[model samples]
Target: MSETETCDLFVIGGGINGAGIARDAAGRGLKVVLCEKGDLAEGTSSRSGKLVHGGLRYLEYYEFRLVREALIEREVLLKSAPHIIWPMRFVLPHSPSDRPAWLVRLGLFLYDHLGGRRKLPGTRTLNLLRDPEGTPILDQYTRGFEYSDCWVDDARLVALNAVGAAEKGATVLTRSPAVSARRENGLWTITTRNSITGETRSFRAKCIANCAGPWVSDIINRVAGSNSSRNVRLVKGSHIIVPKFWAGSNAYLVQNTDKRVIFINPYEGDKALIGTTDIPWEGRAEDVAAEEKEIDYLLAAVNRYFKEKLRRSDVITSFSGVRPLFDDGKGNPSAVTRDYVFDLDETGGAPLLNVFGGKITTFRELAERGMQRLAHVFPNMGGNWTEHATLPGGEIPNADYESFANTLRDAYPWASRKLVHHYGRLYGARTKDVIGAAKSLADLGRHFGGNLYEAEVRYLVAREWALEANDILYRRTKHYLHLTDAEREAFADWFAGERLAA
Candidate 1:
């Protein structure tokens, strides 16, 4: 490589934490460079529970600090990206066989008041037989409690952070992996190879941040050749998507006999997203997939409370992510801490910060604190500004999405309700840019299937760094759920042809 380019900071892993850190650091006027082995959020960040929630169950683990910080972040993230993150109410039906009702109530009480509760409503007891929110539950359950959290577009959250970082003058290299790094003469020299173009590049950075999520240690040991006492426990989490079974928009949190809670949330307007089983994983992080037993476990948990029984055949799609948890010597995989830990190795004058264990709910705070760890290196960098700033296209007035959706309807009454909703919910204030001069649906060009319009695909490709068909189908949008196999094949073929032509 011809003399490595120098930067103030170099970040590995383009997941949420890395992206958030890059955005914050770049906005401080620092020369930043961020690289990811795969696409942005191609790791555990995109394959999450998709909730900006303060892991309610973490209360059992006595993670008061983590829960409180995440709770406070709920509203902050909502304000920052209202189009992608919104409030969600979870109905926890009381099961006498599990924890006592008072215990559940106490947990909810602490959860409601533990953080600065604003915008979202407090928890409320519900009569399962009478309350509309409890209609989906079986008659055996007589009481319930509804508490608030926020839902997030996990993939988009990472993308927005990267976009914000890029706009703030950060060099973000997707599909590029940090091959190696070494500290020399008070600066860290890092080499990266583009996975697509096979181009090798090097940079000299004053500081290095490893936010590789599941690959934190891989980056630390294999790439940076550094050591840290802090270790990561890889706990595999899996989720399954199925057709909507419940009547209301509210989500259900049914406790299993084993004390694990399963979330059945409304997803993509018509479908339902159910997930997450925690099991210790030993396989490669890239090869982790939802096993048959996991799918069964999820179905059994949901079947215990819901009136409608879900079976193996009900599963439409499934995904799995390995949580790079900070190993606190906890025996149970679920008992491990979801909170992040930073290891700053300033052994050779140049500093290396390695992060392990973090959730989507606490990414911003993690980034802020990560920066504070390196404050001595960049003493003159700008002050913290992310907490009060809106993400790209999230400049919706007062962060009110409903009002903006209404405005979109008035402007494009000719557009179908679903199409209007798709744009408003995804783009927010930037929906106009996606819809450009054309007033009618015809101007959107070809329609592949569902809401997969040609204009949106082009925009994702040219602007959002969408390279492959799955990037658009599954991550950028959940059009895979609506499109038939033939339709998907056609879209993929068209996308490949367009790329080849370009």
Candidate 2:
């Protein structure tokens, strides 16, 4: 048995909510430990639709509070992490067969005004026949509307939160699962075993935060031996990556005949990300995959609106995530609320806060509110600090990304514009830390592929808890989509030989 450790709070998930909670708690002067069963954001957090929007479709369900909160959070996050989260224009072409044009206009009006509309521009009507944004659309559709939303690098958001938590004195353990947690003498006796090293550790925590996402109930019932009347509805949404079909940077939101809107967003410079089919998933969350029908359905939706048609072969890759939604007694999975619910089971004074069904957009607010819920448990904790604080590497002056990019270009004139942009976007003010004293590209060491270099890999392993190649390629950065099969294989071989695990 390992020596028993103690912490003020034990967080049992590495997704957005869990990381957000850990970061908030740690910053509030609480000794925290965040243990994840897998790599950070390897689950649903990384596999989202990659937008930080107010959920325009959610308006139909009358989730005004959820949309308003998310919309407000949109600007908040954009201000904090300007490098990764920025404004995006979404073009929605109106069709007579689906939603009424008047209804769409009404919703857009509400969306613009609901959140106190700041920073981002308001919606504008476009004549598809005359506007350049409409060039990709079919000639029959003459009118469309463009609205504002923000695109996010979802996985990096999780990593930055975990980084912030660790920096604030939280112990973050990746690939370590809390196998057991029991209430003994008004304290949580928890045990976590590292999956890689096969090492076990014990802890006596004052409280436990169950932010296990899709496995929220499993942690409550199996790990903590606690029960919750609140339940999570496992709704699986899938997305596909295809070559960019349109000519612009703007994304398209097409209304499908089934009443679900599918997003075809620009991705990876040269590719387009199309997705998201809302289907009820009964199987295990880990086993969720993008079904062929879901892919076909997305293609049909995009093809209906665009002149260029997509086929099965055009799909470069696809991914799916099982959303752990708070079951609101809604028969339709799409109709389920994206709002988060907190269940604090304070039996024996050992509080266990269980978070359920939150979207990526509202994670910071969710964390703040979650901490407020635990105010009784942590009376000495600090006040809300993340509202204005920036995440790790998001320390741009006035959140001006263009000015920062210009500075980087001036500093590293030897580096390509593409490489500088990569570092600027991913590392932001920490770009110098990654590049180090390198005066030229050669100082960056062996180039794996794309903008990926040995220096970046080493930096990720050292700072971001990247123990696996996929953790670097897939999550911390999206070099996987840019690198070729040969480059990836070569990089994996190099990573294994180096034994970079700390």
Candidate 3:
């Protein structure tokens, strides 16, 4: 028999929403327990296009409210996690065959003004023939519009939120699935099973928040034995990674023949991230992967605008994720509203808050508003604070990452430029904790290919709930992309043996 722990909130799922809510709730003086069936952000969160934007395309659907809220959140998120989120300019080549020039200008105008737009710049017209951003663009694309949005390391964002929650006294359980939850004696009883340890734990919670992304419906019906009037519409979006072909730091947004848009963003240092197609998905979310048709479609879209042609062989890797959109009866998956909807079921004196349809940009706001909905249940919990609070590793003074990086370089002059960048970009203020008392490269411990050292691995295991190599390789860092296949296998073997010995 396992011991039962009591908490004020039991949050299911470890994606951005759940982690954000747990962080927000714990900071508000509420006891929080967050459980994930797999590693944090293993689902939709990690597989996103990885942008903290205002959903500029949503303007076409007249989703002004959602876009405005997300737009405002862009700056807030950038301030909170400056280490992981930074400003990026997007270049939209004018396609006379698609949207009219006047409509594009009008949309860009609303996008510029709808949000507060403080740190980021406004939209500017571009001469594709003259501007450097247009060098890779086809000659036919003579005119373009450049606008601002922030890029994010989506998995790290989720991990940092979980770390923030734990720091605020929240319990985070990864690889632990909520097997069953029920309302008993005016409180919800939830049980979780650890997939690795085969240990079971019970928790009595006053409220349950289902932020299960694609599994929201499953948690409501199968796990909690409850139902919601709202249903999640699963839409598949896929992205491809290839060698960076375009010059400059700006991203490209091109229109497809089908009236949809595709983003070609600069990724990692020398790679480009291109995506995504909106297709109604019927298969299980876990089984989602990029198909050949989607790949060809994305290639076609990019080839249509750029002078440099990309073939299937150019793609290094591809990934697909399901969007748990709130069904609005829209026939086209592209037209489905990106807005979120919440369903609160308060029967039998216990409440189950099911979250449906939310984007990464609006996650913090979603968590804050979700807490507001439970204000009556937790009358004494503190008011909203995440809006102004800094996330883990975002403690750079005044949110200036460049200045902090320079200071870090001066402090660790012994470290190479690449090594310093790896630590500064990922750990920020916590870089010292990772480096510890190490004075030299040898002091950092065994080298595991690239800039990944034993020091960083030890730090992640101790603080960030990193239990496996993939957690560090794919999610915590993009070391896998840099390391050779043989090196990755060797590192995985070493990690497994170390964990076993422990």
Candidate 4:
């Protein structure tokens, strides 16, 4: 039999929460091992609405604590990773038939003040008839409200967390699933199998953290053979990508007839990311896809407010994700609480921490609090530190992305404006590592379409754990949106061939 490796912590799942916990625990001097069934953020983490905001709508549910924590976290996350996270303005067009003006104003006021509003600007009223923001709006909606929120590259956020954890001496294994776990001799014995290599590995961990998101219940019952009173409610949220009809960088939030608000955000420089229906999901999380009805429902909501009407054909692509909400016995999916709950099951001498229902906005806080729950286990571990620490590649001086980008442009005078912007936005201070000794565009090697080059691909594979072409084309970078079908196929072929050759 193979030797059983040992660690202080064993983390299941590579979603945002797991990655965050691994990074937090590892930074605090705990030996950590994180195993993911698929690529990092392949689940719900990458498929979020991509906002780090105080859930403006959650205030209706009276979730003040969650909203407040998330609001405060927005600035913290922005400072930590300015490259993938930044401020975004949301335009909410007023509809008399939906929410009353006074109620909307009150919500905005609370949203502005609730979390100790600092760097972001306060809300402003807009005349849809006169302002350029109203150009795409219908004549009926004459008033609008604008507020602040932060946008994040959800996939990149997870990747950075994994990177941060690895840098802190945590073992991060992708494409490896924890198949079974059992308590043995006052410790948890976990067995994981690598899907690609068909190699099984065993570990003896002092404790286990189940951050499987939608698969939390499965991990608890099936994998760990543990029981918890807490349950996860799977709610499906879907988003559609289409050509940008509106002309501004600001996003639009319109109220639907059902009293739900849909966000039409600017995406990929030229596309609009419109989302999200809150429907109770009963299917397997992996099989979840944007249904035709959901797509039509989204188009109808946007068309009701915008002057331009979107059709079925206008939808370029769509995605769906299941939000594993902590079941609060709410009848309405929309009314269900977004707050997270932790279940610490110490059945025997071993401990199993099962995390349930957390949003991307409060992931760091969740990790910090999760670690606190295990403080007694690691009494000598370091105190809170990530609050001010920057993630990998986020070490831009003063957290000023624009200033850093300007410096990057100066350093790479031979690079194109678009290429420089790409590297600056994605790699930040690590742009030099990707560019290396390349003096000009020719040094970047074969152009695979858009801003993707051989050098960038090599860097992602060598540093970011990018094994598949989709990892680079879709998640690591949005090159899929920019590349032609033929170009994408050609790139995939090249990637597969190169991998085989290696």
- Single out the weakest 10-residue window by summed lDDT for candidate 4: 1-10
Q: Give lDDT per model, in order.
A: 0.91, 0.95, 0.95, 0.93
lDDT, candidate 4, 395-441, per-residue tens:
99899999999999899998888999999888888899999999988
Total residue pair clashes for candidate 1 = 0
lDDT of 3 by residue, 97-156 (tens): 999999999999999999979999999999999989899999988999999999999999
Off by over 4 Å in 2: 500-502
| Alpha-carbon lDDT of model 1 | 0.91
In the predicted model 4, the residue pairs found to clash are none
Indicate the worst ten consecutive residues by lDDT in candidate 1: 432-441
Q: Give the poorly placed runs of model 3, Cα more than 4 Å off.
A: none
lDDT digits (tens) for residues 1-502 of candidate 1: 6566989999998999999999999999999999998898888988999999988999998999999999999889999999998999899999999999999999999999988888999999999999898787899999999999989999988988998999999999988899999888988989999887799998999999989988888888888888888888999999999999988778988899888888999999888999889999888999999999999999999999988899999999999999889999999887888988899999879899999888999999999999999999999999999999999879999999989889989999988999999988888888888888877779999999898899999888877788889988888777888999999999999999999898
Once model 1 is optimally superposed onto the true structure by TM-score, how far is the C-alpha of residue 256 displaced, in angstroms?
0.2
Candidate 1: segments with Cα more than 4 A from true spot: 1-3
TM-score of each: 0.98, 0.99, 0.99, 0.99
| Per-prediction tally of clashes | 0, 0, 0, 0
* Model 4 segments more than 4 A misplaced: none
Clashes of 2: 0
Query: What residue pairs are clashing in model 3?
Result: none
